[model samples]
Every structure is written in C-alpha cells, then in structure tokens.
Target chain A: DAGITQSPRHKVTETGTPVTLRCHQTENHRYMYWYRQDPGHGLRLIHYSYGVKDTDKGEVSDGYSVSRSKTEDFLLTLESATSSQTSVYFCAISEPGQGPPEQYFGPGTRLTVT
Target chain B: SQKIEQNSEALNIQEGKTATLTCNYTNYSPAYLQWYRQDPGRGPVFLLLIRENEKEKRKERLKVTFDTTLKQSLFHITASQPADSATYLCALDLSRDDKIIFGKGTRLHILP
Candidate 1:
C-alpha cells in the first residue's frame, strides 16, 4: 500500500537463462533493497541501493546484480538462473535518516528455474 | 554471526484474550527491535519498534517489552480477535548500522 509495485508476479525460466526483476516506487525513497525468501531460511538480503548509481552487495550477493539508474526504479538481475535460485523475491524501500526507519515491501515475485 | 529467533510453534488463544510472542537474539546486542506482521501470500507490515533505552511500548491493543539484559523481546496483543491470526516476525538493528536481521517468525491464531 506504499505505492510500490513489482513486475512479473510469477515467472518460469530455464537454467542458465538471464532474468531481470523490476521494482518501482512512487514514494521516492532513497534506500532500495532486494531480498530472496525461501523455506526454513526466511529472508536474506541480496543487494541494496542507497542512491542513484550507488549500489552495495549484501549478505548473499553471489550470482545476483542490481542497478538503480533512476530514483523510482531498481532492477535485480540474475546473471544465470539456476534451480537453486527459485524462490520468492521481494523489493523493499526505506527513507534514510529517519528514526529507525522501517522498510516497506512490495507484494513479491515468485520465480521458478527448471 | 548475529541471529534472531522466535518460537516456531503457532500460538493459539481464545478471542478477547491476550496473545504474547517472544523474540530472542544471540552473539549481537541490538539498540532497537522491531515487530512485523505477515499474512499468507503477502509482505510483512510493521507493527511496533522499541529502543533499548525504553522498557516497553504500547500502541492501542499491542504492547512490546524489550530487555537487553536477557536479549529478548515480548510482543503482546490484548483483546485479540480472530482477524489477528497471522505470522509475526521480529527484527533487530545490527550494531553501528541500520541493517536489520529477521527471525523465522511465529504463527498466531485466535479462536472464536
């Protein structure tokens, strides 16, 4: 309900294929994050962008890349999709410098690699 | 590595009763803790945040208690209703940064 949207709610792709997931926000937040959720592992951060063209790797950054060219759009790309990469991906945003600012998440995208 | 934990068992209680959930941490001391409610097929919604300096926080029917000494936090919902059934997750802000770590979460159900 925070004016955040994710594209391709569900997708199925073959192994070794490249896939890109998009996240757009109308709130103009400075912080954008990409996370993957799996059974028993909960959610783990993949990458985050603090400002336009300023991106950083997270706890789990292998095989994943992200870009923030504009203020509203943050893109996550899987260089080579694999069956292990199949999981629910979520995009989140937060306003920096706020008092322990809380992140607002998008509905999420489910990806399956065969 | 810092870790956060919550009881995995689903908490069951009668409607109009108070429901309590616990979150514990290890190897890392946090300055603040957060609670979030997640429903099936949806992202989590922020519920409450408590600072280490503060002992407790209350918002309407929801209350949270933070004890740094014990490295645990308690979430309570008074006058619980059937609509409150969902999985509740707790998060902690890591030292010196705003990065957050989350728990697996505990599912809650309110019986009518």
Candidate 2:
C-alpha cells in the first residue's frame, strides 16, 4: 500500500449534481493521474498533473476537470454527474526521478450516479 | 486513431494448469508496454513492463511476450493456483505528444 489515499471510498450521487474526488499522496511523486474504470472500457485516463499548477486532459477528459495546487494533492471534479459517469475511479502517483518507478494506485473510489 | 483490444470474455483454468491472455492494438507505435493484475473492488497492481526492442520478459512463474511486428502482447502464467485468479490489463504508451492508453482487460479464473 503506497502512501496515496482517495477520499469517500464510495459515493452515490444524483444526475446534474457536481461531485469532487480528492487524491492525497505522501510519497510526493511528480506525476499524478485520475482514471475511470468501466466494464467494456478498461482504465481510461481523465486527467493528469505533471507538477503543481500543471495539468493535461486525457483521452476521456470530457465531463471531467482537474486541479493540482500542490505536489501532494490532485483533485478531479465532475461538472454535472451523469449516469454514464458511474464507474470506479483510481488515483495513481509516479516518481520519474526515482529510477523509472512504476505507478502506484489507491484502493479506488466507486462512484454511482443515479 | 489509437485503439487497444482485449478479450472481453473470462478465461477459466484448473489449478496446476497454464493460462494465457492476449492484448492487441492498432495505429499506434508504443515505446513501452506494461501488464497489471487487478482484483475485484481494487485498483490494478503492476506486474511487468517490456520495452519495444525487447521480445520477452519473465519473472517467477509469469512470462510476457511482446511482438511489435504483430502489434500484440501475450501474458502467461504457468502452474497457476487459485490465488492467481484476477483480471489482467495491458497498457501502452500510445502517447500522442506523449500519452498512455489502457486496454479493457481479460479476467482469469483459476478453479481448484
């Protein structure tokens, strides 16, 4: 288990409501990513932050937004929850300066939209 | 467009038998590929990573073969046990301007 933690391990929300997921890391990795896992679609990256105040959209970035104000924290927000957005979300961290380290994942946050 | 394909069906094998999983891709030249193991209700854990120049990599009872020419990768587990049951995922550095992509995944069940 890495020092990464995702808040609200499980949540049930309604459509058209905004929701936020938080990822906190103690390893202080330089790279952090937010991904969603679905039945037919594998793990799809929604957003990633290379460093504080730097972020980029991933393949499935629509309906999702991210913010990273510090090296140890990254947040993902769903502007308006949709039934299609119901999926297990994972947070990952990687240390590029630490000898090609592999990404470590959190336990995961299961989001269900009604 | 870059796309990754994996077996949507689950693979069932008896204990002491071998299991193989497949991952295929198209329209993308990846620099590196990785395999991961995930259990239900949990996130994935890294298993192995193979480079584009490498053909195969192995660890313990697990073996991975990557064929760039075929644009596919095969993962094998020998003499698998019930504990080896889990979903396997393959990811590539599809990287449009440097990005990564993941395949849906193939579930494995080791029956005792």
TM-score, first chain, each model: 0.97, 0.97
- Please give each candidate's TM-score: 0.97, 0.95
Candidate 1 residue-wise lDDT, A1-114, digit = tens: 498999889999999999999999999999998989888878788999999999998888999999999999999999999999999998989885866678888999999999
- For model 1, the local distance difference test gives 0.90
Give a tens-digit lDDT track for model 1, residues B1-112: 8988897557998999999999999998787899989898888888898988999999999999999999999999999999999999898886646568789888999999
Clashing residue pairs, backbone N/CA/C < 3 A, model 2: B95-B99
Clashing pairs in 1: none
lDDT of 2 by residue, B2-72 (tens): 88888656999999998999999999888888899999998889899888889999999999999999999
Error of 2 at B79 (Å): 1.0
Q: What TM-score does prediction 2 earn? A: 0.95
lDDT of each: 0.90, 0.89
Residue B5 deviation, candidate 1, in Å?
0.4
Which consecutive 10 residues in model 2 chain B have the weakest lDDT in total?
B93-102
User: Residue B10 of model 1: what lDDT?
Assistant: 79
lDDT of 2 by residue, A42-109 (tens): 89999999999999988899999999999999999999999999999999988754654467899999
Q: Positional deviation of A67 in candidate 1, in angstroms?
A: 0.5
For model 1, state the Cα shift of residue A79 in Å. Answer: 0.7
TM-score of chain A of 2: 0.97
Q: Is the docking of candidate 2 incorrect, acceptable, medium or high quality?
A: medium
